[model samples]
Target: MSSLEIVKQYYTSFNQKNWNGMLALLHPEVRHEANQGDVRIGTGKFTEFLQKMDESYEETLTDMVFFTEPADSRVAVEFVVNGIYKKGEEGLPEAYGQTYVLPAAAFLELKEGKISRVTTYYNLPLWIELVSKPRND
Candidate 1:
């Protein structure tokens, strides 16, 4: 498969919350960086991250727009993920069914048709608010 196809499927798998499919597109030594400075490496760590994301949200990914330039070997994706709280999360100020439309982007690097490195850029502060976890004490 081409890099673009691989990346596209990656998003599709994630939106579907298909852990197995998502894992298949990831390199064994894949590395991921989110908005935070923290860097996650290894398949185990990546798997954990996916698990947490799935466990937190109630709905699946909705509208998404993908932009790519074949020459650059990079793709930028913007999407709105709608979901509710899973209940019993300490920072959760409200119950389930709260709707959130988060606009997020990700920069990806492909190697051998697999995702090797991913740098995620998004408004994390906005997410905190959407998830009802205000940073202010």
Candidate 2:
């Protein structure tokens, strides 16, 4: 499969919250560089991260645009993340189902049709501020 197709399928599975489907597209030793976090290696680490996120937040990705250059194996994607903080995280403001939307970008490297590395970037302060504000409802 082409890199574009692989990436498209990955996101589609992600949107569906199909954890197995998403993990199937990744290498066993996939490298993950989560936004504002240390680089983690292996699918085990990725699964743990997903579990933690699932516990703390409910999120969806929207307005996605994927970019790739000729002769490059990397794909960069821009999207908006809309999320509700369901539980408080360490060193973060309290969570009371506060919803926030923010634009983010991710760079992915594919190896033999499987994602080997992923690095994402997003505004942490903007998210914290938005989620920290007092909710009217």
Candidate 3:
């Protein structure tokens, strides 16, 4: 499949919370960077990250637009996240199922038929502010 097709399926799998589906697109030694975290290598590390995220937050992406270069090796996606903080997380604000909307982006490097590297960007402080708001909970 094309890099763009892989990326589109990646987000579709993500929105479905399909851990296996998301992982299916990764190269065995895939490298990943989440938000501003240090780079992590391998599909195992990526799996752990996804598990942690699932435990703390529930989110869906909306208004997604993708960009690909002529070389067909890289793809970038821009989207907005509609999410709820389901539990308090370390080094972050209180959760209590706080609702938030935030913009995020990701860049992917495709190798062979799988994703070799994945990097994502988002405004952490803005997300904190949104979830920090006094919730009726």
Candidate 4:
């Protein structure tokens, strides 16, 4: 499969919350880096990370911006992830109710049809603002 195909497969499985499907596309030593303060490498760790992430989000990956440059062996995807938090915290207000959308971009490096490395960027500050408690001071 080509790099673009691999990326689409990743997102498609992600949207479905299919951990095994997503894992099938990753290299055994795949390294996943995110703006969310987690570093995960290796298939086992990566699977655990993904499971936790999927559990954290009330909404899933809904839309994707696609790239199809096969020569680069890389794929760049921009997407809007919409979800709700049943329980609120510092990054999300409790009384504000449970809906949030964070726009994100992820870049992936592929080798032999599997993801070797992935870097994800997103607006973490916005999430903080949405979830932050109002100060009494």
Using TM-score, give the best candidate's number. Answer: 3
| Cα lDDT of model 3 by residue, 1-137, tens digit | 79999999999999999999999999999999888768899999999889889999999999999999999999999999999899887789988988889999999999998999999999999998898887674
Off by over 4 Å in 4: 70-72, 87-97, 133-137
Q: Rate residue 41 of model 2 by lDDT.
A: 97
Q: Model 2, range 1-137, lDDT digits (tens) per residue?
A: 88878888898988888888888999999999998778999999999988888899888999999999785688999999989899998999999999999999999999877999989999999999999898677
User: Predictions ranked by lDDT, top down?
Assistant: 3, 2, 4, 1
Model 4, 1-137: lDDT tens digits are 77888889888988887779989999999988988767888899987776665555566776788875748688889999787665444454553445678898898988877999988998888876665646444
lDDT for each residue of candidate 1 in 25-120, tens digit (9 for 90 to 100)? 888998899777579997789998777766766656657777778664677777766666664345446555456677777888877777888888
RMSD of each: 4.0, 1.1, 0.9, 3.7
Clashes of 1: 0
Candidate 1, which segments miss by more than 4 Å at Cα?
A: 87-97, 133-137
lDDT of 1: 0.75
Candidate 2: lDDT over CA atoms?
0.90
Candidate 2 versus the native: TM-score?
0.95
How high is each candidate's TM-score?
0.80, 0.95, 0.96, 0.83
C-alpha lDDT of residue 110 in model 2: 92
TM-score, cand. 4: 0.83
| Full-model lDDT for every candidate | 0.75, 0.90, 0.93, 0.78
Lowest lDDT 10-residue stretch of candidate 1: 87-96
